[model samples]
Structure formats: structure tokens, C-alpha cells
Target: MFDKIKQKIEKAKGALEHSDERVLASIPETSGLSKKDIYRNRYNHGVNLGGCFILEKWIYESVFDKGGDNEFDAVSSQVNHSSVDEAASKLTKHYNDYISKIDWNWLKNEAGITSFRIPIGYWHVGNGQLLDELPFEPLREVYSRAKPWDILKNLINKAAEYDIGVLIDVHGLPGGANTDMHSGCKNSSPSFFNKSKHIDKMVNVVLPFICRDACVNCENVIGLQVVNEAVFDNSAHGQKSYYSRAVAALNRIDPGLPVVISDGWWPDQWADWLGQTNLAAKVVVDSHVYRCFSAEDKGKDANQIINHLSESISWPRDRIDFVVGEFSCVLDEETWRKTAGNRDEWVRKFGKVQTSNFANVASWGWFFWTLQFQYGDGGEWGLVPMVKKGAIPRRPQGSPTVDENRVKEIINEHIAYWKDKGGDAMEHWRFEDGLRGAIADINAFAQFDNSRIGRWKALAMQRRAQYISRKGDSKYMWEWDQGFQRAIDEFGRY
Candidate 1:
């Protein structure tokens, strides 16, 4: 069935014009770099630096920190009273306070952190679902804070001023994408797969930012990331179609800015969808890989650790020439485990662990998982915390001290060797080979269905099963088989 689908795609190859014609006409040609650099644009390792406005999401979405005070104030109260919630709240306060004081300019100018990814959720900036119909009065009041245009300009100006490349990611979606990442939608929301609706929001509300002169103010603002981890289910094509529409909208703006796309988060493996993209050379595909949760952590041997990291990343290497948009290597297992779930701790740790073993062979420059959100188990990813409710927090003030000089030294002394001695350099596939095999296994399962719609359905079913099994809802997983079957039947119709 999958082979038939692949054949069908091949047959309609002419009809399926993958490239966006508008984008090709506008973007400036790649100049200055050698042909090799131009070809490997996908390999630029960029980081999402600066402060993100995440606490605002929680404030607006009604995901409060339980205490009427902000998460920070609440934490103070909780800690004083010895309440778990108070401890969490105090942690949140401390984290946000720390980040808000961060020096954004220092990161770029002084530290040489060249790339930064900034996230602005749909709702926080007057573009989210509850924009016109927010329920809570406080939420509605908060939603009225800043318009999208204002935020876009602010981001562009910051990037241009700092001489850092920017990736303006649509961190939130209407009705919400079902993921715990930045977009705070609850788990398994039906809204995740609602393709047409998402496209509408992207076309009308989000795409304009890509075209704005503010965003295109400089080459430093490289691309527009449509959605961050829209991974409720495994609808790769559905994700692609939404991204395609996003690219099409940008192309219309006549800004030859590349569209950065990602594979919805799945643990196993993935194939590249960006290679076949229809756009000019400006398109820079991206992916994020962080696998601290896998059993590979317990393997204990140094060889096992290397094998695990290598296998974990094989998918990104094979699928697209993407930068490791976000990742980290935790040296202490106990500390790392605590950090993964705590946003605040992650940021603190990420700030400290500037030298990584993986940095030497990194496909692209690395963006650590976070800079803020200091309270909670994995809050370490965040540099500081914003006392918000559910999703990732905003970039706080003040820059945490990273061993940037040491980091540069490591990269120059070690990783730079790979760039110079081409033949002697470790092969890209060497690191990513294991994960590639897993994706191949899945792609084989995908090949038979000639219908893209059917393939999407099958993938969604896989996601549902995975979610179900992980959640220990075997009964619901079985019960939902009929529903999944019906979805496949309905989607297969057209």
C-alpha cells in the first residue's frame, strides 16, 4: 500500500510542484560564501537567544500558578509555608527575576552567541484563538497587551541591532496544537490535526510577519518558523501542508526569506521532508533533538552513551540539512534527570554546560533547549522563569554567564578540525545512522498507501497508540481503534 502511494506521488510529480514560485523570485542570491557553504545553508547551527514572552501565555490561557500572586510571588509564599506549590512558585519567581535581568546585547556582542530563536505565542500578541473571545477578564486584559505587528518589529529590531540571526517561531496555534512545548494546549487536543483551520490562522494572522520589512530588516533575520512542535499526532504531510501554505504566504510578500520547518516531535526516527520542498535556495530546514528520557541513560558504559547520542540524532542528519535547533548533553545523570522536567533548572544548567562532547561533531551550531523558566523539574532549560501557567516562559532579563570564551575555544580547537580536513572529518551519517534505521522502519510501514491522506491517517493512529500506551490507558487505546478506523476511512475519501 505504501509503495503504491509513493508511486502515485511519483506519477503526479509534475502536478505536485513542490517549490513555491513566488519565493524564488524575491530572495537575494547566496553571496560571499563558497558554493559549499551555500549548499550547506541547512547546517548552520543557530541558537534561540534573547528573552521569550511565555509567562504571558499562562496569564492569558488561565494556567495560573495557583496562588493569586505571580508564579514567583506564589513560590515565595509556598516556600515559606513548606507547600510544594509554594516551592514551585518561589522557584518560578527566582527564575524569572534572573532572566529579566539578563543582558541580551552581551550575549551577541560580548559572548558571540550568533543566533537566537524567539517565540511569541498566538494569544500573547493578539493573534491567538481567544483574541476576540477570551473568557477570564484578567486573561482578556492581558491579551490586549501587544499587537502582532508591534512584536514582530521589536524582534526584528533586536536581531538587527545585535547582529544575530533570528527565527521568529509561531509558538502557539488556534485551538492549540497538542504539545507540552511552548504552545500550551492540553494533551491530545483534537485541534492539533485540524489542518484547514490552522492554515487559515497562518495565512491571515501569522504570515504577515514574514513579509514585514521589520522582519526582513536584515539578513540576520533568516527565516520564519511556522509552528514549534505541532506534534499532537504524527501527521507529517499535514504538518508539511500547513508549512507549505506558510511558505506560500511568505512568497507572496516577495521577501525571499527561507521558511524553517520541523518534524513534529516523535521519539523514534524521521525522514527529511524539507529536501523535496518547493522554494528558493533561501529555505533553511531545522529540527530539534533532545532524548534525555530514553532508556539509553541507564546503559552506563561510555561507549553506550556515545552510541545512544549517535543513534538519537541519526534521524535529523538524514532527513534534512538542519541545525540542532535545541539540545544538550547532561554529564550527571541524576542532575540531568531533574533538569529535563524543570524549566528553570535547565536554563541554569544550560548556561553552565557551555562545553559539550557533542559540540565537536555538531551538524549545525547548537541552541540549548532553553535560557529561562527556572522553577520546576526541567525548568533548567529556561534561563529564567516567567510566572505563567502552562507553556514555555518568555525570555527574562539579564544574561546568565556562559563560558562563551571556553565554548568558542572548544569549537575552534576541536570542531573546526572537521571543517578543515574534509576527508578526515567524521562523516555526518556516523552520528545519525542508528536513528536513520528506525525512521526507515517507519517509512517502510508508510510506503504502501498511495493516498497521502491514508498515510496521514496511519501516522495519526500510530501517534494515538503511542500516546495511549505511554499513558497506561490500554483500555482507551483499544476502545479508540474504531474511532481511528473511522478517521482513516473519512480522510481516505478525498
Candidate 2:
């Protein structure tokens, strides 16, 4: 791979006029594996590169905001230009500076992450976002001048140099998908809920990554997320029909390409829908679990928090195929103040538990919310800081493993039962096939103490009901709890 890249570099030098984009695109993504390889029972051990491509909500005031409100406001105000060309020029400098600050090499080689999530706004297509929504002329001029999408494409290709996969996340939709500024506009009313065409527009931008031609492609440019944090009510915004439309469109393009969707406030609701759908195998649900946002965390300690996370969130979460999209080791301000021992040790312990629970429960693993953004932005909550300080592990551990010895025992027991019951009929069953089948079952159920889906349902309901009834936040809990029960019904007793 190094030799091939060196040769490309040498070739590019000869052809001096070849644009930087063309020169960078020449590097080959050596990983021969497709997107399916990452999602098919493989845990996603990764970090989200937030605030690099898009000015994220968390990083907005710190980085993008000089005096303005959001990314759009800040860029326009900072540039303060009447000429579109001048605005674009200044924006180009700012865009490149942020991208340059990221250490992709360290993320891959040192951090040991398998994937990186690149968040982009819908307007990343170039100038416009939607028909009557968010004109963004000032930002548009800059994007047009910088050709930011091309730079992003180059970054995707460059990441392939270390065989790291990229999850293309459409962070900001046309009108604000949610009340967040990251959605481009800060309108509390979700303008994206009713807009079907906007979904189409986002998909149009996403097609290239998943549907590469026969010649050049990056193996690690794995999949595309429709939108980042969509506002989901019973309405179309975050519900199934909304996602169904996006999923159907993508499947029409390529059914094999993995499509990731944020649970849109109700992860428990989609459990049955995803498992039963034709798109189940190709779809991934993203559930952002954050304790910092609510007033409820003010009273809880680390032990109470971790316990609640395990029983209510993590264990029940195992019943479905999902990933903990965003998480941080930073406890609530009050919790932090009351905690004892080394703060670093506390962070390490919290991070370890969080990662362990996700690996053991969620079908795919977790991604730490961010790498590093500003100069000194990473610490307790940041992935790079946790890694540098040894708070989080570089590479994630394997899937929630089974007791190999116990599995062998179960297999031997099953084999003996078959042998006793079937005399001449035993010849029908191949020894290897029967043994492998028995072993697989054992591995599948060992996480739940060798119990199958039927028993898992009973226990999950009991545990979750107790949690929700006792201390569940969110007024949406009742609806989601019902949805969780419905999912259990759909899967049925295995």
C-alpha cells in the first residue's frame, strides 16, 4: 500500500497541473472488506469526528462562534463580506484549518478505532439545502469557493490509508431536524418532519459513497447515515415511515449498503420493526445515551448511575440490534463534585463499564462521541483525552463472549440426548452439524445465562418494567415501553 501510494505521489508530481483532489484520490484503500463486514455481527469500535466537517452543537460556541449564534451566523459575521467570492475565500481558510487540526494518523494507528463518523450538513452538496428553507447565502459562498465536499471526499480517501472505515453522517438536514443549531437553523419547530423531498436531497448527496464505480473506491468508506439527531414524535420525523422511505430509497440503490438511523428518541419502538423487516440485516439503529442532559442526574452517584445504565438501559438494549451512538465518561456536575478518589481513576472505571456494557449488549459496539476538536478540547468527555490518559481502551474487546467450557458441556449433553433418543434415526443428523448447531446456541444464550429468547423476553420485561415504573425520565417512556413489549412479541419464543 505504501509503495502504491508513493508511486501515485511520484506520478502526481510529474503531472503538476493535476488538482490536489485528484492527487489525493489516487491513494488506494487497501482494506478489501466491504461495509457488510463491519456490520455483520462485528462490533463497531470507533470514534465520532464531530465538529470537523460540520460545526457541531457542542463545539459551536467554542470554535465556530466568534460573536454569532451558529456555524452559519458565525461564518457570515466573521467574513463580513458583500462579495460572494470574498466570503468563500475566507470560509475556505477556516474550513481547511479545522480539517488540518484533526490527527487521522493517531486516530487509526494509536487510538485503535475501527471506524470514524464524518458529519456533514445537507447543504454540503454545495450551495443550497432546500427549496424554501435556509438560504445560507453567506455560508454557501464559502462552501462554493472552498468546494468543501471535495475536501471531505479527499479526507475519506485519506483515512483509507490506515484502513479505517468512515460512517458518512448527514448531521444537518434542510430545516432544523431538531431544535439544535447543528441542524443548520435553530427553529424549535422541526421543519424536516413534513418534508419528504428533503430526505431525497440528502440521499442524492450520499449515493456516491455507497455506490462507487468498478474502478476506484475506498473499502473503509463503509456506509451513510440519513440524518444525525432527527426529532421523532409519533409524527413522520423520527418514526418508521420516515425511515422506511429513506431505507427503501437506499435499498433500491443498493440493498447491501448499511443504513444507520438515530433511534429518534424511541429506540425501543423499532426493535420489532427492524428485526422483522427485509432491511433488518442492512439497518443499524443509533441510540444516544447521555446522562448529562437531564436534571435527574443531579442526585445520582457513579455507582447509582452505572447500575441504572446497566439494568434499565444496557441489558434491555441487548434485546435489539443497536449501537450507543453518543456517550461520555464525564459525570453530571453535581456527581463530579461529590465523587472521591482520583478523578482520572473514576473516569477510567466509568468508561470501562460503559464500553463493556455496549460490547456485551448492543449488537454493534459504541463510538466515543468525538476525537479532538480545538487545541485543548479533549479531557473526560473526549475520546482522545480518555485514550491519552488511559481512561478508555484503544481497541475494544471482542463481542460479549460465551463460556466456551460451558458451551462444550451443553453440546456434549445435547449430543448424548440425541444419541439416547435416536438409534437408527441418529444417522440422519451429521455429528459435526449437530455439534456446531448446539455450540452456536450455547454461545448465543450464554450472555443471558444460557437462556434462549423466550426466557430473555420474560426477564427483560420484568427488569425494564421495574426500572421504568420506578425511575424513568422522558415523558415518552410509556410509549417506548409499549414498543419494547411489542418487539418481544414479534421475535417470539425461540
Ten-residue region with minimum lDDT total, candidate 2: 24-33
The parts of candidate 2 lying over 4 Å away from their true place are 1-41, 57-66, 79-83, 126-139, 203-216, 235-238, 315-320, 396-410, 413-494
Per-model TM-score, in order, reads 0.52, 0.71
lDDT of each: 0.42, 0.57
List, residue by residue over 248-305, the lDDT tens digit for candidate 2. 7677766555677877777765666766564555677777877766778767777677
lDDT of 1 by residue, 1-494 (tens): 33453454344444535654322211111112222121123223244532345433232222244443232233233444565444433333433453355467655444444456766555544323344432122233323332333555555566556545566666656555554534533434536446575567566665674456445445566567666665535556666667667777886774446566555565222343444552423344445655445564543433344445544554433223344566643334643444335544443333333323223233334565555433342343442231122122222223222243643443344334456666253432211221222222222322311111112222333344443443344432332333333322322221
Alpha carbon lDDT at 140, candidate 1: 32
Error of 2 at 341 (Å): 2.9
Query: Candidate 1, which segments miss by more than 4 Å at Cα?
Result: 1-46, 49-51, 56-100, 126-141, 146-152, 232-235, 265-272, 277-282, 296-303, 315-319, 331-364, 373-494
